[model samples]
Target: MTSDKAHNLWHQTCAEQIAAPVLSGDVTVDLVVIGGGYTGCSAALHAAQLGASVCLLEADEIGHGGSGRNVGLANAGLWLPPAEIRKHLGDGPGDRLVNLLSDAPRLVFDLIARHGIACEAVQNGTLHCAHSPSGLKDLQVRHTQLKTSGAPVMLLDADEAAARTGSAAFHGALFDPRAGTIQPLGYVRGLARAAMQAQALVHQHSPVLRLSHGAGMWQVETSAGSVRAKSLIQATNAYHRNLSSTAPEYVPVHYFQCATDPLPEELRATILPEGEGCWDTGLIMTSFRMDQMGRLIIGAMGDLDHLASSIHRAWVRRKLIELYPELQDVPLRQGWHGRIAMTSDHIPKITAIGPNAYAAHGYSGRGIGPGTVFGKGMAEALLSGNDISLPMPAIEAHHERMTGARQMFFETGATLTHLIKARF
Candidate 1:
C-alpha cells in the first residue's frame, strides 16, 4: 500500500536502502523466521551469529510494515504505568520486564554503533510533555515510580519545559535521559544487512502461505519456495498475514504522522534546539520532534489516510498553529499512517504457538527497543528450547476479546475527536 504521501518521509531521508532475494528454491535451515521487521531482522541476526543456520522471510520489502513507519521515539517500557504492569503480571515478573526494557535504548544504540548502521541515531533524550494540569500530575506520578525504580528521570518545571520545547503550551515534563530516537527504517534494514553478513539468508516478497510442523521440523511454505527448519519465529507484529498459523491477536490502533519541510534556520534554532523527541500525556497522545534535517514531525492517534483523514489533517493544522503560532500555514510535506497491535492489558506477549515455534507481538506502540530485545531473547530461547533469558514469561495461549469491535471503537473515537477538535 505505497501511497505517494504515505511513509515517504522516511524513504526520502533514508541513508540506506536494503533488499534481499525472493525465495527461489526450497532450503533447509536450523531456524526459519517470518516477517522482516525489527523483530525478525534482529532475531535472524542474533540466531545466525549464535551458530544457527537462519533464513528470514518478509511479505514485502524489509521494514515495510510498522517497523518502518513508526514515530521513531525508541521509548522505553510499555505505555502502561509501572504499577499497572505490576498489577497485571505481579511483582517479580513485572519488575523483571521493566528492568529488561529499561535497557532498550542502550541495546538499540549499541547495535547502531557496532554495525555502523547509517540511521540518524540521537541519544540526547526524550520529553513526555504535560498537556494539561492533570497531565503534569500524571508525569509526577510516573516520575516518582521511575525514580523509585532507580531511573535517573527528571521532572522539568513548566518554565524549563517551555524552554526545551520552544513553546509555552506544556505544563511540565518528565525527562528520561536513557531514551532516544532513530531512523527506524534505516535501522531495521541495517539489521537485515548485518544478519546477511552473519550468514543469515533474508528473502523479500516471500509471504508465508502455510506453516506446518511434523516429524520434528517446521515447514514454512511461500509462493516460490519453502523453508524447513528445526525452529520458527513469527515476528511479523502488527502486519501478520495469516496462513496455517494463527497471528497474535490484538486491538489495532492507528497512528498518523505528518512531517513538515525543513524549518528555516532561525525557526529551527528556537524549536527543540537540543533535539529531544516529545509526546504529550493526553489519552489521545500527540507527539512532536525534529528530524536530522530539521523537519518537524508531528503525530497523533488516528487513521490519517482514510475515512477521517480530512478532519484529522485539518485538526493537525490547527494543532500546529496552537503549538507554534509561527508555523501557521506551513505546508505539511507528507503524511502517513501505521497500525499498532495493542494488547488489552498493554503488555507485549511472547506466546508459544506450538513446539519449537513462537509468536511475539503487542508492543502497544513501543516496538523498536522491545522488538530488538525480544528478537535476541527469542533466538536464544529457540536454541535452548526454553525462555530462560527472556524478560517476560512465554504464555502457551494468547487470545484477545473483541479485537474487531475494539479496533473499530478506537478508529471511531479518534475520528470523532478529530472532527470535533477541528471545529473547536
Candidate 2:
C-alpha cells in the first residue's frame, strides 16, 4: 500500500526524469553509499571529485524518494531559527551549520550551472508567508536573525505578500533572496549523472539487505551481489527498507502534495507571478509553487495516501479555493505523499554507528540544500578520517527513538487534525 501510494501520482509524473541502470555484479570501492537520493548522489559526486572510488546503491531509480517529490524549495537553513538552533546545539556548532547553509543556495545553483543540469532552476527568491499575527511575529524574529547573519532578506507587508503570492491568506511575509526552486527530480538525476561522469558507480534496483563490519572494511549485502568498501554511508533518509540493525532512529512524518492541471496563462501570470516558491508559517505548514508548465502545486502536513485519503483530498480542494478563490474550478491532476525522517529535534545528524561506518538521515522535511551540504561533508569526513567534515559537529547518536504510544499518539493526533480540518 505504501509503495503503491508512493508511485501513483507525482511519482508517476516523474518516471522518465532520472538517468539509467540498476546495480549488478560485485565491485569494490573506497566508499559505498546506500540510498541514491540527493544525499547519496551528492556524496558520490563529492567523494569521486576528491579522488575516491565511489559506489552508490539505490533501491529504486534515482529520485524515487522525497528527493523527487519535494516542493522544490532550495531553502538556506533548517526548520529551526538561528536562535533556537544556537540554543539547542550551542553557539559553536549551530553557527557553523548556519554559516555553511546560508550560502547553500549559491552552492546548489553553482552546481546546476557547472553541470548544465536540465532541472528548471529558478533563483528569484522564496517567501515565507505568515498565516496569522503570531506567524508574522515569528517571521519578524527570523527576519532579525537573518539580517544579523547578513542574509539577503526582506520583510513584506500583507499587501506586498498578497501581490507576490496572489493571495490574502497571509498576514505578511519574509522573502529570502538566497533561496529558490528547482525541478527536484531532475536535480537529483542530474547529480547522479554528474557523479557517474565523474567516475562514481551508481546502480538502481540494488537494495542493501545487510551491512556487516569486519576485516577493516564494511560489507554491504544485496540480493544481486555484495560490495566491500573501506567506509560506508547510510544515506537512505526516510525511504529506508529497514535492512539493517544500524537504521537511524527517527519519527516518520508524512507530507503530501497535490498538483493542479496547468493553469491558463492568465492565471499563471497572477499566481506566483515572480516564480518564487512559497510556504506558510503555521504549525501545520503549507507550501505553494508554480512549475515550469504552470501547474500550481500546493502541499501540506498530512499524507494524502494514508487511510484519510478522502479527507486529505477534500482539504486540498477546499484549501485551493480558499487560497485562490478565482481558481475554484482548478482540477487537481495528481496527489502523492513521502515520508520525512524527522528527528525529535528536527535536524539532520551524522551518527558513527561503528568504526569507519556511519549513518546519516533525519532531515525533518528540509532536504535539498541540507542533503547536499551534509552529503559532501560526509564524503570529506570519510576521506579525511576526521569528524570536521560536517558543517555541524557530528553527534555520536541522537536521543532515544520515540516509540510505542508516543509514535501512535503523533500519528493519531495528526490524522485527527487533518480529518477535523477537512470536515470543517
Best by TM-score: 1
lDDT of 1 by residue, 74-127 (tens): 887778778889899999999999988988899999999999999899998999
Clashes of each: 0, 1
Predict model 2's lDDT versus the native: 0.83
Query: How accurate locally, in lDDT, is each candidate?
Result: 0.88, 0.83
For residues 303-357, write the lDDT of model 2, one tens digit per residue.
6556766777787788888889999888887777777888877778888877776
lDDT (C-alpha) at residue 13 in model 1: 83
Give stretches of model 2 more than 4 Å off.
1-20, 404-407, 422-424
Clashes of 1: 0
- The true-versus-predicted C-alpha distance at residue 272 of model 2, in Å, is 1.1
Measured with C-alpha atoms, the lDDT of residue 215 in candidate 1 is 99
For model 2 the local lDDT of residue 284 reads 72
